[model samples]
Target: MPTVLDRLNLALHYAMETDERVTMLGEDILDPYGGAFKVTRGLSTKFPKRVLTTPISEAAIVGVANGMALRGLRPVVEIMFGDFVTLIADQLVNHSSKFRWMYNDQVRVPVVVRTPMGGRRGYGPTHSQSLEKLFLGVPGLKVVAPNALGDPAELLAAAIADDDPVLFVEHKLLYARPLLEPGKGDLIDFQVEQTGGAYPAFTLRPADSARLTIACYGYNFELARAAALDLLMEHEIFVEIVLFSQLSPFDLAPLFSSLVRTRKLLTVEEGTLSLGWGAEVAARAVERMDGLRVRRVAALDLPVANAKSLEDAILPSVQDIVNAALSLVS
Candidate 1:
């Protein structure tokens, strides 16, 4: 019955308990207010010295975290909004991500930068932007955008335990949903689950024979799921959906094998179409496989719209994904 926010907080608690070196930093994270979305609630009280509240500077927050990582401490820095990440691009893309390689593995920067990303709920353009694609292109940075509530807990634990810098992008819309069934193992239990193991992989009951694959991340996974249901009920066409919680250092071996069986691919993202993650996936698919047809359903190639109606217009909808799937079948 725990909401996504509750699960995230639990994950943080587990991280703090497991690692004596783990620390958290950001605005409004220390005391009463608990974080803008309350994901960091009670953490300040539980780990007084480890949980730090900072000024309004994203650059400073990331810079301080990078310095800490250099000194052998794992720092989890929270950026209240994804849109604010642009202001600290130099710190993230230039410094933290490059330190290890730049120094020939002489230093390892273990920093997890968490930011609430995506649109909807009228946050408008300034506060609502999906910039995961921007960080995905940078070398030495691990990017993760977990769609399921349970995965965030596990994935955050894994990212924190990693030696490299990670961009843990949490979707704003997914924070209020119920915990995903598969990732429901007890937080106190530290057993490692097998790869590709599913608690319950929802399959379209009818099972169309078409060779089309739907790949998506973050909130777009929800839209793709709804569209997949519609495709099964109305069109009798079934497509396989591969939801990736871990984006950078993407393990595409499974996806590539699936693609060989399916023969067609469609990528959906909430971010802009041009130079987005979808584009990279499509390009990689083409390069790795011969005679593969791939398409992308993403936000229009324009600046994020400030108006709610225009914002909705720019983002990929269920209809868009469905149409793309249908096109692959046709």
Candidate 2:
């Protein structure tokens, strides 16, 4: 019954309680302020020694967490906004991600880099951007984005316990929303539609037919699910949706299996189109699956505008998914 944000807070509480080595680092993530979205509220008070506040430097915050993790602590770091991830790219990619392999498995960087992405609240171009796609290419980091149906708490717990570093992406708009069924009402109690193995991708098939498939993750998945339902109800087009809880080490099995029936794929994400994460999914699909058609719906290559109108125009929407799927079907 908890919201995605609620689940995330529970995950942190659970991690700290279960493991003495679990620590949290971020700016103003203390009581009252909680965090930019209050996801880390009260943790500092609960676990005073483990939950430490940091300066305004994102790079320093990550560097400190990396050092702590290298010393055998499970560090959960919160980057205030997704856009700020660029500031810590060097530490995250070059250092945290490489330490395990570089040390020949003698060391483990079990760090969970948590950050909020997307822009429905119109925080302007700098604060609101879905740049998760940028980290998808990093060799050792695992990219994870939990949808409404999936439990962010469970995923975060898994990420915290992981031996390698994890990029846990949370969308801004999804914080307050209740975890509802893909196309169902808010009253519907949240349930994980599909339990994923290896790569943890949840599949939701509203009906038996898979005329088209929509593969997406993060908060934007609500838009994709709504469009899928509209297509199913009005146009009688059944679309199977796969929401990924884990982005890296992406297992193409579920997608390829769905493609066997659908034959058409429409990948969606909030990140910009140029070399976006969807592009990688499409490329891999074609490389393995023969006679498959793939289309992608993503944000335009421009700074996300602050105004609601401009933001809607720039980002992916329900109409965008519908149009892309219609094109694939036609």
Candidate 3:
């Protein structure tokens, strides 16, 4: 019985096995070391000719992936950390993202740039930034930040199948979480038991007694859930939590309806408050839903510190979310 991450690896392994065009390129994806997070473990051994290890340069990695995509190869490029992608923004935003429209749909860049993002364990400013907002504004690029552990495999597979560039951001915090294997089998049953409990499936809605709609994604979803529980238990208030798995090509239909129902919206994220994903969500909610009362919960507009205390202060906490929700309700 494979966990969700294990299933994701298995899917990638199987995809590469069947499709010769499916290839991988990253800093240390080859055998022995696997990947920095072992997501690509044993891939190089299985597909020696297709799996490639590149230098530490993200620009080069992205450039090569873009070139391969243009030449009819589906390249899954790993950028060790999300923070490092700033170095390759030129290739990702300018070339890979715009190749289709710039060339009048003459070429399609079917590339999946996977990166581990978010702050945990005091990784510091250099490695803690969540840059999804930077690429969200880029046209011709699809951004996906999967909330549940099991969602990434299907989402990644879909991204790979699509004939467009996709930025698949996987939170480092979710790597070890267990996910049930898809399909009915002895393996699936065993894995389901190993998961300990049912995987949480969340939805957004307007609550009749709700004061605020807490919109979140990735690790923030966990915090938002905890806060919702706290609000129910401690304050007798119900807050609707909306988790945004797909960030780019922003879908506000569900959120807009929720805003109309709740009237108040609070966007939360682990990233900085200024010009972050939460701000964008808040802005859009207000733009689309007239008279919506919107607020945001996010890290301060300052660089994260390597110190645990400072990092904790900057990152949104479950308590902070609860307090904000209560404030809105009261």
TM-score of each: 0.91, 0.95, 0.89
Model 1 misplaced stretches (Cα beyond 4 Å):
182-210
- Candidate 1 C-alpha lDDT tens digits along 140-227: 9888876653366766777888898988898899898776554233211112122342211222212345467777777777787788
**Cα RMSD, model 2:** 2.2
Write the residue-wise lDDT of candidate 3 on 32-55 in tens digits. 998988889999998999999998
Hey, what RMSD does candidate 3 come out at?
Answer: 5.5
Worst 10 residues of 2 by lDDT: 183-192
**Model number with the top TM-score:** 2
List model 2 lDDT by residue over 1-330, tens digit each.
689889989989999999999999998898878888999987988998988888899999899989999998989999999999999999889999999998898999989899999888879999889989889978888888877776777788888888899989999888887776444572132223566553377777654567988889888778887897778777888788877778876666777777887889999999899999889999998998888998999999999999999999999899999999998999
Clashing pairs in 1: none
True lDDT of residue 108, candidate 2: 91
> What ranges in model 3 sit over 4 Å off?
1-4, 180-209
* Deviation from truth (RMSD, Å), model 1: 4.6
The 10-residue segment with the lowest total lDDT in model 1: 197-206
